[model samples]
Structures are given as C-alpha cells and as structure tokens.
Target: MKLPLSADPPAFEIRYGITEEAARRKGYEIRKRTAPPDPSPLDALLKKMSPEAVKKWGETLGGPGGKEAPNVSVTMPNGDEVGAPTTGCDAEARTALWGSVEHWLLGQRFGSDFREGLISRAEKDPAMRALNVEWSQCMAAKSFADLESPAKAMDLAASFYEKGDETTAFTREVDLAIADAQCENDTDYVRKRRILEDRYLAAGMGGYETEIAATRELNRGALVRARTLLAS
Candidate 1:
C-alpha cells in the first residue's frame, strides 16, 4: 500500500494558473513587494495555545501530557497567561468545527456524498470496471503490465518512492502518470465515470434533503462566527 504524491488528478484540458511566459515576471514582482500581510486574529488565538502547537497538534509525543498537551504560553499586557496551539492543531480544530459544511453542501447539491462514497461508487461501477479492463490492455501495450486499474497503476508508481533515489522515483512516477492519463483519454474513462456517477447520485438523493437544509442553516451561522473571530 503506497501513498500517492498528489491526492487528486489535475482537471482535464484546463490551465488556470500563471502561464509559463508570465510566471517569471509575476513571480519576481510579487517577491519585491515590501508590505507584509496583516496578522490574522485567528493566528494570534492559536499562538496562545501551545509550543508549535499549531504544527504538531495531532502528533503523539510521549509524556504525561501526551501530544495534545499545551507546551507554549502567551502572556497578555494585563498579566494573563494563555496556552497557544500549533498550526496543525488550529487547522484540525477548524476543520472539526466546520468540515460538515462542505459535506452537507455536496450531498444536497450532487445527491451523493462527494468524498468517500463517490470514489467507492466509481470504483465499483460496472462501466468503470469494463473501462479499467480496456485501460489495462492499453497499459500492457505501452510496456506497463500487471496493472488492473488506474488506481492500481498509481499505487504501483507510488511504491517506487519507498526505495531508490527520490529523483529516480519521481521520474518513474511521471512515466506512469503520463501513460495512465493517455490510457484514460483513449478509453473515454472520464466520460463513462461521469455518466455513472450522475446516475448513482440521482438514485440516492432522497435521504439527503432534510440534512442538507439543516446543514445549510448551521453553516451560515458558522461562517458568521468564523468571520467575527478572524476579524477580532
């Protein structure tokens, strides 16, 4: 079981970022700016939480306090001391508090769970399975054999990273990614996946309506609170 370098694939046929010619000039101009960004109030609050508490919030450092224990303290002008959190902790706390907002929105708008369920459905889809078979055949023709699916091919590519020089591993990864993308294009894999996904979402929409409405109201309130905190 190897981990992917990137968690998701690039969008097909779209280039939204700075172009190659524009990158050099824009990059230099941005770096030359003198004014620094204003400090975020949320950042100040997290800084009052622990030592690198922001970065190592979830890590398991052995001790009586464990990893979650506050290690850093901030003192106010009024002689009050407060614990500060690391970056990781602040991010995790924020997500735990508001992550449900996107989940509900996706379920309501798409009629399916966007994160795990959609991927599960796509993998198990009959059309997707057939496409994978075709894709595997295409890969074999390209001298990349023994791969059963795009996911499997990606996993194999990731496995290379566990040994050898990082540059070598990266080169092999690029080769595999190119071949996988080419196979997907040739087999119309993306089109078929989209069609099947729509069907799956349409069939499962009834159960999400009430939850979606409730989450919408909850998210609105949460956004307001978040704005207030950030502003403060």
Candidate 2:
C-alpha cells in the first residue's frame, strides 16, 4: 500500500545530535549534584552514638571510634518522592534548570502532526485513491496482501512489542520495513503521494508559512540558550 506522506525522516532528525549532546550534559549535571560522596565506616558509626559517650569511649579505646556514612536519601527540589543518594538529581529540577534548551529541542520536532494532516487530505484525492489501489496490488504480489496501507504496516511493526523475544521481533520488523520501502518504490506510490502532498501544501502556503516560521524561531532561540549552557 501507499506509504504515509510523512514516512521519511523528520526535519528535526538532522539536528538530533544537539538533543543528544544536551541530554548527556544534563545527565552529567544531575549525577554530579545528587550522587553523594562515599563516607568512612567510623564516621557512620559515630553519628548514631551520643557525642559525649563516643568521645569518652574513644579515649578508652585509644582513638576516634566512628566514621561518616553516605546519606540515605536526598529530597528533591520539586517535592517529588526522595531519590536515593546514588541516583541522579530530580527530573523536575533538571527540567526547570534547563527549560530553554529543552523547549528548543521540542520545537524542532513539531511538524509531524501537520504533515500527517496533509497526508490525510492527499489520500482523499481521486488520483491518490487509484494510486493506492495499484500500490495494494503491488504489495499483494510481494506476499503482503493483508497490509492495505503503509500506516497499517507500521502498526503491525509496532505490534511486535507485545510478545516474542525482543531481538527476534526487531529482526522481523527490519524485514517488514525493508519490504515496505521496496514495494513503495517499485509501485511509484511514494512519488505520487509526494506530488499530491506538495500540491496540497502549496495550495495553503500562507498558514503553513506562519506556523513553520514560528516554530523555526522557537528552535533558534532555544538553540542559542542550549549553546550558551553547553559552553559554560
């Protein structure tokens, strides 16, 4: 069947490295702040004892008799459940501290829904329906007759998560995905759908331009903040 109009990699996928780098930096900061230092056993023992008794006992024993212990738990800033001292900082606190960077990363990935809507509109066109019929026949010839649309195939791919060994399921998904791509290419389904989608998008360029421009500016502002944070 015909592939969805937005099956190609997203525009933001090109800049995804920025999100990866920022996430790593954020994780480092959280770990640095929340992972408590290890404590000596003597200090740990002494804190549980009264100071006077410990001091008197230390003299009797010929040395300080206690060591510091690691903290048991850390209360996060957002008042969520306390995290173990060995864990990373609070998720809410990290978001608050680096909100601008996160916002930009999200803005870069906002157009998928818009593209999907365009695809839906394109599918309603008489020409697209005929192309879809051809695409279905092509898929049937390849022994995937049960799949009526690329979206349905995608859903089937996702269904692999429900059961079976994960690696085996993933291998099955790879095979299906490759077949889907090849079938779409062979049938020229992708090319025809792309032409229709472009025409639809061009027909309503005004609203699209405004939405895209706003999203672009949001990403630009966020990227600037993310760069500053990383440099610091």
| Global fold similarity of model 1 (TM-score) | 0.52
Q: Look at candidate 1 and tell me the lDDT of residue 99.
A: 55
User: Global lDDT for candidate 1?
Assistant: 0.52
Top of the candidates by TM-score: 1
C-alpha lDDT of residue 65 in model 1 = 37
lDDT of 2 by residue, 1-232 (tens): 1111111224421100112233323311222323578888976887788867666554443322223312223221122222211112222323334353233223534455455556567779998778777767776777778776666655676676578886666666556555666666676776677788798767655556865776677756656765777899
Query: Cα deviation in Å at residue 215, candidate 2?
Result: 2.0
lDDT scores in order? 0.52, 0.51
Q: List model 1 lDDT by residue over 28-123, tens digit each.
A: 122222336679996577668766564443342211233564344433222333332323334344444455423323222322223235456656
What TM-score does each of the candidates earn? 0.52, 0.44
Show the colliding residue pairs in model 2: 42-66, 42-67, 43-66, 43-67, 43-68, 44-67, 44-68
